[model samples]
Target chain A: MVRFEDISTPARLAEPGEGIGRDELSLATRNHGLPLEALRYDLTPPGLHYVLTHYDIPYAEDGDWELTLGGHVERPLRLDMDELRSYAAVTTRVTMECAGNGRALLSPRPVSQPWLVEAVGTADWTGVPLRALLAEAGVRDGAVDAVFTGADHGIERGVEQDYQRALPIETATGDAPEILVAYAMNGAPLPPQHGRPLRLVVPGWYGMAHVKWLRDITVAAESFTGFQQATAYRLRQEPDEPGEPVARIAPRALMVPPGFPDFMSRARVVRPGDHTLEGRAWSGHAPVTAVDVSTDDGHTWNPAALEASDDHRWAWRRWHFTWTAAIGTRVLCARATDAEGRTQPLEQPWNRGGFANNLVQRVPVHCTGL
Target chain B: MVRFEDISTPARLAEPGEGIGRDELSLATRNHGLPLEALRYDLTPPGLHYVLTHYDIPYAEDGDWELTLGGHVERPLRLDMDELRSYAAVTTRVTMECAGNGRALLSPRPVSQPWLVEAVGTADWTGVPLRALLAEAGVRDGAVDAVFTGADHGIERGVEQDYQRALPIETATGDAPEILVAYAMNGAPLPPQHGRPLRLVVPGWYGMAHVKWLRDITVAAESFTGFQQATAYRLRQEPDEPGEPVARIAPRALMVPPGFPDFMSRARVVRPGDHTLEGRAWSGHAPVTAVDVSTDDGHTWNPAALEASDDHRWAWRRWHFTWTAAIGTRVLCARATDAEGRTQPLEQPWNRGGFANNLVQRVPVHCTGL
Candidate 1:
């Protein structure tokens, strides 16, 4: 029999000249990215939204489901679906992106899910505030974290366990960024593919923190070092290094390709003349303040008009640019700057796990008369 | 300037020892497959269904959209969304599989979308039967094919054009297998990713035949010679050889891997005990009549109990087998046999385009105490 504690290295960069592996291809086939064209919509339709499921989408009947709050909590409670839905519901639009969004684009890329720049989406979620539940459960003194456990169980690296991740107590119950136990998406009951019945939704954070198929919320007195928290989703240069944990999503901007694409290569072709280029930009750190567009690669940048409002503070803001095209091959790029003054980098520093590498998008287009 | 007709080879295999290219990886990111665990659902959720779009999903408002039927039809007609919906609607469950489902599994695989099974789903489609529309338009006596043109346009292999495919006139108006102009899926209006407003759903055929973002139906006096119909999706051994066209889906069965999986490799780990091996089997040629299960790869097979019914003529059938697990490592496989005496091949013949490959699935698992 194999020992349970014999775990292996958590993250490794792909060897030189190594293309995407079959295992990574398998993950790609199962999870999907948002087509950059889908940026046209303010709230992405569920089917068009990018998805990254770490394990099997757990099968659960909502009627028979229960959520338990225990451990360091003063009042341990178990609530069924009906009891859970009894709480007042609030709906909010939030943009969520995977930490590994640009993994495949990295040099000596990580050998995990091979994602491009499309692994991001904005959605309207409806649920009860997590703060309300925490208050009702009565948190005890000295509770450092609230561990959320999902029904999805699987092995990661060499350790087998249910999917679990913890949030600092302040972040979990903070008023500035309301955390939710969402039961609905875009006004409809959550579909099976998107953590049906119920799921956790943490605004302004990367998708990994929003545990799906949630079953338990255990208030803990100490930091919880689960496999997902301390192992996989981290930034490190070497195998022995204890990397900084990945948390909030980095600022990013993506433009809708201005013209039709080649079927296989996806190279764009457009007619010369006046055209309006539009896209969406977001930052989990702060509200997006400015967006810049470049027609001749990143050599020169022009400020674009931003359509921002107080209503979509946690969601992506729309931006547009008008250009008079000439002809020949050209490269287009877009970059965003958040209110915190953090602009998207042209080239991100490489890390072993390939987390939060939000490099500006570069699109190639051939302009000519159609 | 690039000439419009300067086309290259329609299909080419990957160079020996070369891994999947970045272009193929890009396609994999945009498209997605049904997770094997999702077989538990009877009608697949739209977001989880396999999607393979050759070009951008055309944006069209339902109120202004129209489908034109002309050429060789005695009474040419243009029908708006309202007019189309006024016809009697039929709802049918269909299991659609991509023609290139097992493309990546082949040696020197075709360098396009790198799919490995999982590219299949069953859905309840609601729409007007194609025969009714064809009868109203009155197909002319000399008409031999009904050419479908979708609004999605792009360049494939150096040739730029709108997406187009064709069905024999008889097949388009046949009673045995009704084709539809589908507008709704799973009782809701079709999502944007699934060709919102209107699309063609050809029952008992590969997904390529179900043209999405449909804009026109032109009856022709000759068979279509479009790139998708005449070049791509064809089964061939050499690039120079004109091969047989890919149409119906071949017989195939996939088991839901027992127990949990390793997050990276996706290899299953099960506790040593009795487990029910369950899966879904399907074929476009005919109803699935039998299913077989093997624990030791394909070395030995045992008959499985099929839960088939005439109600789901064009949909997949459920199958189950009981197995006792007490092993270190095991490879489980499932195979299906259709009513037409066609059984899934143990090993599929290699083809240039990788179409209609139905090799039995092999799932590696480790059975031990958790």
Candidate 2:
């Protein structure tokens, strides 16, 4: 079982040799009291790692399910779940992140759980390519978009609601094998919370587009504008003017930010000694090009090696570095850059809604001389 | 009631003069739906309109509330809903569109709602400037991003989910007075489906970032990353690759594609001798500089008279021109150019998800000999 106390790290890292605060330390240890496992690696403990679910887990008994492919096509066909699984199965490791991972830290803190980091996770997924199914169904030239609907229900305007969204046709049947009708997670049957029978594994989109309890798939020459498409999962504010009538913002193609922030900076301690620094680097768009560690605050820098990943496209690589200290207090920092040359900035520009927060992350660690 | 059937228009313009196949007619109708009141322009109309909600219409009596401002300020205070409503509210005609407006038309067809070209609507919104509230709250430096949270909720993996997102602080307290903490929509107390008590109105963004059930606000040096941030609203597909792992996609700023296909061409069955052709022209990132209408399809074109708006940033203007029709059948097309010298293209390159579909739209109408 995963014990929060055994693996709980303070939200803010403590300075070298400094005693951690009782409140902060205790707060860190309180497990929502759930049982979890710790799959330890050099980086993110496998047990404490994140998991993304597209559709509710479907048991084998729900076996006789069929996937219907119709609309703007020469031929339409219905394939059962068994028939789909019969195709060549492909497995890939991918890192999934919630779009609003850094929203809690925004000023005028918006009403949210205020996740203090740790909302992202990577996992190996196994599924059948959607392209195979589309080809089997004989998609036609005029096909424009595909719609995916899920079984989960929620209250909207006091009425029970089912979550649904769509993707353009190009993404639905693209040559890229990223689109999946996934059936397994981390090599195991999907958890109940995660979509089980069959879920779309769209690697590079916000979680909203990855529907849970997926029930239906439709291909058409037009796009779908259900509640999720037209009303929800959108950016309400304009880029230039914060206070304007809510306009629908487009889904930005995901790309890593320009720079990585120094999450270990501003650390102080009651006790001081040689200190080792650590942090994590990830991007939804590109692989980590390099990670640089700095000690003397910002004056000097050293390179940190990144851990290898099974799939370079799906997981974040962790980095660590050690620093020698002989004085009272010193600031520690680390910065990461992606292969695309985007790096974290010292500070991100202020926006009304904090959709993307890849600013230099600084943690205060107080150190005392030993 | 809001009756969907009443709002729909007859299929007069779509059908070819001769008998057309049901499949063809369906395809044409799906690709293009005419506005009920094509000529009656008043921004957003009641029947054929768009609605954005905040927190499921705060429970009427309980909805009477106030906005409180505190933290790192000279004075902590509360602005009651009534008193806040007393502030001068300004109205501006603006066009609001879902970022996924034309997503269905994309090749491969992404997994999204089948939005039938009617996801866009224009309306004159009335709201008090957010700047006034910021001034009253006495915002201090170091404020990075403003977070907005709404009352909307759904159960995801047994977790009670609240819709929330954030924006840059500069956008929240920017020079433009376009940012509004809206209390009314189209001269009416916001409908329950629309944030009744209060909601943040931002122009030019997708609808998701606007929190529906706004409640509390907090200021911070950093930003927040909840489920919505980390998962729900991000892109996971690699933008650079035609098809890469979805996880390889990074969340970037939203982009609005310019120009609509065949936007300048329209046909009217007036006297069979001479008729006027017209269409709307606008851009999300820049203002429309000129519009060219073509009656002979794309063979030749004439400049159309462009209407002007007081604030061209938020609204799109209408343009029209006259043309002679020679009975039988003729193809009409329209194209537009923006201030940045970007002209409408015949087609757009296919992307995996089809987030930006600004290809020139084509509508073919048949005129019988009168």
Candidate 3:
């Protein structure tokens, strides 16, 4: 007997205190979440699709924001939006999710936003390759890390500071020209809500790696440890557990399971009969090679028809399963395995911050007798 | 040093299997998820907001869809959308979250939708009260529960069935008029994506209690043991643990801490200085009575001023605290207490399915030397 009231504490919204009013509270909620309804595709979700900015949106005036490349470089250089735009531009569809995308889903709720699955969205980012910008600065030897800084700064917790993060020198130059100092998204100038003027788009990495409102690039001999680097975005096992900073996304499969309304949290009313269950899959480490759909509660698994993706290393693929649903309750589960055989598990390894929770997704459905 | 590879399996999007081509994959991804930037908020996130339907959306013809009230009642009544609309209409604001809103946040993530915190949203639903309609149906004695049946159905896990949930006869009648068979949302007919024509909104309860595209109301002599009622949505300890079904929201306080976009996930660059921090707090058990602010990682706490709310039992209150910040890294934390003397814990008891994950939210900030 699962008593409904046994849930103990059934608080609804984190109600507003006297500090804010209904209107203000409304604004705050909107400011933080990219609605689930915005979800469209499984691949290339769309640039303006979803974003997780660390600070309030900063508006830049013409010639105001500048990207200054300094540190252990032979020729330190500073470039504005227009100047950076003059360089060769490349466009790529990248999937970006917040490092804390599942923070709220954690049992104890990690110290981050209470993000739902909606924290993810895909976008086509156009920008100057980071390697090119670094190359123009003539990087000197002994630089171990490339530190990226954003213009949005504020008091987080209690410390007043600027936002900064870092990537290893190898990663900065490896897929030369893939990491971007982007100025445009979806063929339009970067929206202020997104980092305008310039932002870093680390294809396949979590959103935090893509520093917004880019302003400085420091080629340092040591790793960078600013606000976001040293403390936030790290995947801890315990509260005090010193863990790795969250980065690239984990491979996972998401389908518009019959009744689910795209990315919205609301379930759709599914019907009894045969249905084409389909969705997109992607991976950062390796290409998605196989997808398995389980309609009988993982009892018997069947391989879903797969789609070959483009040559783009970061592009996603589509998969489908023809489900002859019966008149009853069902849990339609989808699982994917990358080329490296890194398959999604029934349960994701639990980390402190709930980062990259890419377990198999179980979508519940009910078919009417009618 | 947490290496980027430390994330172990850095897979990106759920890629398609080796079947379809890039073009087809593109079409599939676009088939779901709304574009992220399209999010708009009223009290609720909207029809496309945080809805989770059970079966394929059932289309009801103007003359076909009907609401039948029977079982244990004296005079069974049948009404169409038009007839139901003729009853006295009432409207109210309600914040609804999926019972599995924080599903993905769970450790060893549950076998369900990999939801983040965005699985919640508020809405103003207008409809005829359930009790009023029940009265017209004339409930007879010996009725212990009202089993609400939705037209949606399907196979869940392995069980074939329709979607049905029950409400104690008392609650159905006690919260008279508040529980409505809603037809209009934000002043429009319910969108098909959101249970077109008819749906139930049980205020203060999780989204599961709000049946959508409703069809039948059966007054029963005992509790219902449907799949969702006895099996799914329950908080189990071990995999085989018989857990209770999750219900009601818990007491929670969340502030739009600096660095996080005012209402967006985009990081807001905060400057070094003293700033007033505020946000909303609420509890389903009782009204929020007090809130405490902690700046030094929970070392000390200070009382925050609370705003008195009118007698809207389900509404939340806003609260605020002031802090003088220095240029450095910091953590901002807020804990809330309800009028029942139930204060939030620094650590909430961990539960399966990650239900009621209402621990305090900590926001990090960084102040530069500048």
Candidate 4:
């Protein structure tokens, strides 16, 4: 049994030369990433999309579930699934990415969910707008933040509580991004792993802000400082430093490996010929404006054609390039630049939590006879 | 670039005290196991079901796909999706477990997919029977085996080829244990991760026998030797020995951890009181007859109530046990017995490939105040 003090110790990076442990492997087996090749689909199939669950997927029956809107509200309300679904609904395509998407790639990696660039996926979510519900509840005077709590309860870093994260009052009541209380994914009811009855979908923010298995929303008069927000998803180099809270995703572009993979090594093998390279690029801050592909590592690059960004602005944009291959082994890389002029970096700054590290992706390929 | 000779090196057990490599971690991120808590549902959700893809999920268009049946068949034929769907279809709920489900738990674990139980799920698969398709093609006399090939192509152990596996002709054409040319899962068209257009589902066999993205069927007059059949999925202790091929899944039982889990260690914590333990048990060899639960780490055992097994005989059966908890740390274990009197072993013998290791499960729980 872990002692109480040991459980409360702050998160730390893996020791130098340390490898992924059994604990991290256990978490990896439970959570999955979008297979890099799945980028071919515009709206990733539900099962193929990435998933990251902090605790057990709470077993819930829709008929017995209820969402309570209380705490510093004009009028407290509790609504069942049917009542919640009665509101006017809208469907929107959004790309969601975990805050720790590239955690394992960091030097002296954070020993949590060991992700390596596959932690992003786009989907069409259907639900009632969360701002509509907040307007109906009437956020009382002096409300500073809104806390959304999921039914999934567990102990994290010694504190035992329901999983939760809070959004600033203006963001919660904002009209532009269109926050949603989603109940369906792609066209079907949310699967157990995606949270059954209801979940919060915060567009343009990291996945931590999009709480799943949502059961309660409390409008608070003070800034909400939950363990997830204050302790876990922070960008800090030292344990004692209070770092910036992670939010919007950084711009990143990932390609479908050009050729077949070696089953054990995953090294690509492509015959010498002409090939069409396609991929998806996205950013939570703004629409993507440009994508660049590199055949000789990052030494030289060529611009790729970007798709029109008028539709699905909050989702990924398709990009493509044509390449003529020669007989040799080479490294392929892709980088994206958003409308706000934020381009992916060749190297990402390291942090204790390893949140939002969008280092460029490099795929090794062998150009030889198949 | 990987040397050709290095690519041909056989898979070996991890060096003593060595950790999981980046290659294995990359594979784990792409594939996933069912979260143990999902055992509560009778029909596991599509997204929560465990998936293992040896190679990439081949891109397929149903309208463009055609299944060819030839080789030793007296009447070689090709059928498109519409024609294949016109035949009589049957839906069956089968519990499928990976042959390497408990691989990581073995000492000196094999350096492949590092699975630790949880690599099992039950789903309702719908499609036309393979025997019917075989009858339509009319197998010729002296046919010894049938080879099924998938569209996923890759290099494994220095051999570049489309993934292929073969089954004895008698088993492929058998009346009992019906095999399916499946095209749907859980009432929906096959998801890309599960195989897009078509797949093979062999009831009462480990998942290795179920080929995904199936495209071709060839009947042979001699026993077929393929890499997946003769090399990878064998139970041998020596590198050069050709051991028994892994076919049927051994009896096994896994319980949903009784209480909430620690986010990192996954150690269960429950308030000191009476608690009910629930789990699922299955065996591909025969129907599971009894399940025994032990709170003292297999030292003392108590019988659990088993649900009716007449329906969904090929699927898992639910079992439950009530335990009164005391404030302390305890180990929980569950073991299953099949109708053929085959019970799970307390410890599994080590093998080079780490296939078919179904020892009893041990869950560590802290029965203290939450």
lDDT of each: 0.87, 0.49, 0.65, 0.89
For the candidates in turn, chain A alone yields TM-scores of 0.97, 0.70, 0.86, 0.97
Candidate 4 C-alpha lDDT tens digits along B196-299: 78999998899989988889999999987899998889999898998999998889999999888888887788888899999999998889999999999999
Superposition error at A39 for model 2 (Å): 49
Worst 10-residue lDDT window, candidate 3 chain A: A2-11
Task: Flag regions of model 3 displaced more than 4 Å.
Answer: A1-370, B1-49, B53-64, B101-111, B115-118, B239-241, B260-269
User: Could you tell me every candidate's TM-score relative to the true structure?
Assistant: 0.98, 0.40, 0.52, 0.98
Q: Model 3, A95-214: lDDT tens per residue?
A: 666665544434543334445454566667899989988888888898999998888754454445567889998899777338988888778777665787788889888777888888
Worst 10 residues of 2 chain B by lDDT: B257-266
The DockQ assigned to candidate 4 is 0.66
- Where model 2 places Cα greater than 4 Å from the true spot, the runs are A1-370, B1-39, B52-63, B68-77, B155-160, B226-271, B296-300, B310-313, B328-331, B349-353
> How well is each residue in B197-258 modelled by candidate 1, as lDDT tens digits?
89999988999999998889999999899988887878878777778999988899988888
Taking the tens digit of each residue's C-alpha lDDT, what string does model 1 give over A1-370? 5333332235567888888888789899999999999999999977888888887888887888889999898899899888888999989899989989998999988888899899998899999899999999999899999999999988887888898999999998786789999998999888776777888999988999989988899999999999888877778888778899888878899999988888777778888898899999999898899999999989999999999556878899999999888877788999999999988888766898888998999997888675
* lDDT value for model 3: 0.65
Q: Backbone clashes in each candidate structure, one number apiece?
A: 0, 152, 127, 0
- Residue lDDT tens for model 2, A61-121: 3466566667777678676767777889888765555544444445533322233333455
Residue A329 deviation, candidate 2, in Å?
57
Ranking by lDDT: 4, 1, 3, 2
